[model samples]
Target: MKGPLFYAKILLFGEYGIIKDSKGLAIPYNSYQGALKMSENPSDVAKKSNQNLLKYYKYLSDLKTDLVHFRLDELKRDIDGGMYFDSSIPQGYGVGSSGALVASIYDKYADDKITVLENLTRDKLLNLKHIFSLMESFFHGKSSGLDPLNSYLSLPILINSKDHVEPTGIPSQKQGKGAVFLLDSEITGETEPMVNIFMNKMKNEGFRRMLNEDFAKYTDACIDDFLHGNVKSLFGNVKNLSKVVLSNFKPMIPMAFHQIWQQGIETNAYYLKLCGSGGGGYILGFTEDYEKAKDLLKNYKLELVYRF
Candidate 1:
């Protein structure tokens, strides 16, 4: 059986801000996607993925009814029928691999699943977030539910505040040297430990202040600038955001990329930031000149996302 595919998502402008009701934006990145399928035979990865999903399903089943809702029996039946995820998205890469899987299962099995075709009002969106949070908590210890929501909706999600979000439009890309790209670390990174580090660091007043003031400001500006096609302003905010990430999120950066990160800041050729809870995995980069950035960042793999 073939099921719908859900693409991976990227929180381009918001990382930690939207958790505090700050403005944020997310876009669907089609480069990676996952789908549910049933096969008589399965590979090791598929077997492992399905086994993990069973554990997740059990967790969801055990959740208190008052806290969340879903149709668990249908999910069980699908699992019993050899239904498993066949996906190209890499796990531990911060590209919503698990999130897409979770969303696909929920879409297929939940009795009262939110239909993307229905009137997706603000209240509905908020309810989905609450439900998705409970559903996805099986993977990440904590979840905003934004990744799964974006995967489910398959749209660019804009966060105006904690209580408001909707599909958004981005400007058409133009051919140019400038780009937003992903650099592979060729290793997997765990989200829990990185998130733990972030939570621990939040205890520091200085870190909290920077997150609230500088990080939030630049993140918000970048979202606004990108949506409005303010290219000049977007790059300016990206540069500052890159700097803030480099200064405060050292633990998240892969060790080998440290010099390249610094070189970007010093040369203004490119700036890199954690794609998602980086310890390894992929790091996102913004470059005014992709060729130069690629040359300078040679010896590593790069994938272009968008052109400026």
Candidate 2:
């Protein structure tokens, strides 16, 4: 038995800022995806996945929540019958790997799950986020739930604040020189530890002030500028955001890419921001000229996302 596919997601803006009720924007990234499938003869990878699913089933069964209930019996039956998630989404890459898994499980087993076709009011979106948060806590120590929410809906989501979130439309991609891209850090990141560092940093009064004033302000502006298709303004805000991240969020960034992150800001070739929690994963990049940015960073691997 095979279930439907679930895609990965990119949190373009507001990574850590969102934890503090700052606005965030997340979009579906179809390049990497996963789906639930079953096989009579499972491969080694499938066996591992199935084993993981068994643990996840137990976790779900033990969860106490009114937000959503899983059909644990059927889920276990499927796992017992050699069902596993067949996926291309890389774990620990800042892309929504576990989010896709949570989304797939909910898609197949949740009772009275909110269908994507239904009217997704603010309350409904919040409820889904809440439900996903509970389910995904099995992976991340704590979660905002935006990753699974984006994967489940397969649409752009805008978080106005902690309590307000809704489906959003982004400016259509254009074949132009300006672009949004990902730079492979070539190092895997663990979300839990990175998040722990941020949590610890929050105890510093200076860090908290910077987060509330500069980080949130720039993140909110970048979201607005990108959505409005204000390319010039977007770059300006992205530069500031990148600078702030480099200065304050140093621990989250991998040591190898520190110089490049600064080079982009100085040269105006591109602006780099944390793709996810960012101990190492993919670093999000914004450039006015893709070709030139590509030329400037020729040694590093780059993947184009959206074109301006």
Candidate 3:
């Protein structure tokens, strides 16, 4: 028995900004996905996944939350019967691997689950985010729950603040020169360490001020520009956002890519930002021309996400 697939997600804007109640936008990335399955003859990988699920089941059983409840007994029964998560999403790549797992588990085992077909009012979306936050905490020491929520809904979600979230529509994709892409740092990032760094940084008065005055402001503007299909304005705000990230959030970026990140801004060919926590996963890039950006960064691997 196999459950439906859950896709990976990209937090297009508002990475660290959302923690402070700034606006955020997340979209489903269909390039990689995962689902739960019961194998007749399990391989070593499948067995390992089953073992992890066993631990997760225990965690969920002890989890105290009024947002959502799971069918823990049935989940345990399935695990004993050789159930495991068979997935293609890369782990520690900032692309929502654990989130897809969380989403799949909720879909298959949650009692009174919120189906995607339902009317998903604002309150319901908030409830789902709250539930996902609890479930995903087992993986990430702290979680905003946006990744799992995006995977579960399979829709673009606009986060007005921590408590206000709802599904939103992005402008139609165009096969044009301007585009959003991902650069492969080829180094895996651990979410815990990266998040810890951010938390530590948050303790600084200077850092907190910068986050409020600069980071959140630029991120919110970028979200508005993208959703409204304002390409010219979007690129300008992204440029400023890229500069702010490079100057202030240096620790989150991989050491090797610092020069490239700046080069994009200096050259105006592209602008680089944190894809997720950003210690060393994929760096998100925005460019007015994909071909020119590709040529400039020929040494690194690039994957086009959306065209504008």
Cα TM-score per model = 0.96, 0.99, 0.98
Q: What is the TM-score ranking, best to worst? A: 2, 3, 1
- lDDT of prediction 3: 0.93
Q: Runs in model 1 with CA error above 4 Å?
A: 66-68
Clashing residue pairs in candidate 1 are: none
lDDT digits (tens) for residues 1-308 of candidate 3: 98999999999999988988999999999999999999998999999999999999999999988888888889999999999999998888888999999999999889999889989888888888989999999999989889999999999999999999989999999989999999999999999988888889999999999999999989999999999999999999999999999999998999999999989999999999999898887899999999999999999999888998
Best by TM-score: 2
lDDT of 2 by residue, 148-243 (tens): 999999999999888999899999999899999999988999999999999999999999999999999999999999999999999999999999
**Local distance difference test values of all predictions, in order:** 0.85, 0.94, 0.93
Q: What TM-score would you give candidate 3 relative to the actual structure?
A: 0.98
- Residue 174 CA error for candidate 3 (Å)? 0.8
Taking every candidate in turn, the Cα RMSD to the unseen true structure, in Å, is 1.5, 0.7, 0.9
Q: On lDDT, who's better, 1 or 2?
A: 2
lDDT score for candidate 2 against the true structure: 0.94
**Any runs in candidate 3 off by more than 4 Å, and if so which?**
none
Pairs with backbone N, CA or C atoms under 3 Å apart (clashes), candidate 2: none
Q: Write the candidate numbers in order of decreasing lDDT.
A: 2, 3, 1
- Candidate 1, residues 1-308, lDDT tens digits: the string is 89999999877877767766788788889999999988789888778777877887889878875634677887788777777888998889988887898788778877667789999999888888777777888888998888899999998899888778888888889998789999999989998888889889989999999999999999989888999978888889998999999889888887787888889999988888778778888898888899999998898899988899
lDDT of 1 at 292: 97
